[model samples]
Target: MIDTNQFLAQMQEVLEIEDRTLSPDEKFRELPEWSSLAYLSTIAMIDDEYNVIISAADFRELQTLGDIVRAISERQP
Candidate 1:
């Protein structure tokens, strides 16, 4: 099972907002650092870490951080 805390920590690192606290229901795009760069960085992080290849369209469709976690979890064993 994927650890939510570790996921959040990786997300914070990827988004370059390690100081902020992240919640599962938080809207990822609402973050101040969320941008094209952040989006691509997230995609890369998810792929490299989770071995899940999420497309740009799919990434754009994600709303909450929980949604992203579920997506990755679904892709893995």
Candidate 2:
């Protein structure tokens, strides 16, 4: 099972977000570090860590960090 806390930590590390306010409820796009590179980083992180294949277009459609958690969660066996 994918832990949400681990997800947040990986996001922080990948996105370089030092803010402790990082949470699933937060908007992924509102982050100051958010960019095309960050989007690709996130895709790579999820693919590597969760073994879930997510595309750049799908990441663009995501609104919140929780959406990512849900996406991977649903894919979990």
Best by TM-score: 1
Q: Per-candidate TM vs. native?
A: 0.89, 0.85
Model 1 C-alpha RMSD vs. true structure (Å) is 1.3
For candidate 2, write residues 1-77 as lDDT tens digits: 57998899999999886757588899988878988888878888888888898665765677998899988887765
Error of 2 at 36 (Å): 0.2
Give the alpha-carbon lDDT of every model: 0.86, 0.83
Off by over 4 Å in 1: none
lDDT of 1 by residue, 23-74 (tens): 9998998888898888888889988998999776776788999989988887
The Cα error of candidate 1 at residue 28, in Å, is 0.6
Q: Any runs in candidate 2 off by more than 4 Å, and if so which?
A: none
- What's model 1's overall lDDT? 0.86
Provide the RMSD of all predictions against the true structure, rounded to 1 decimal. 1.3, 1.7
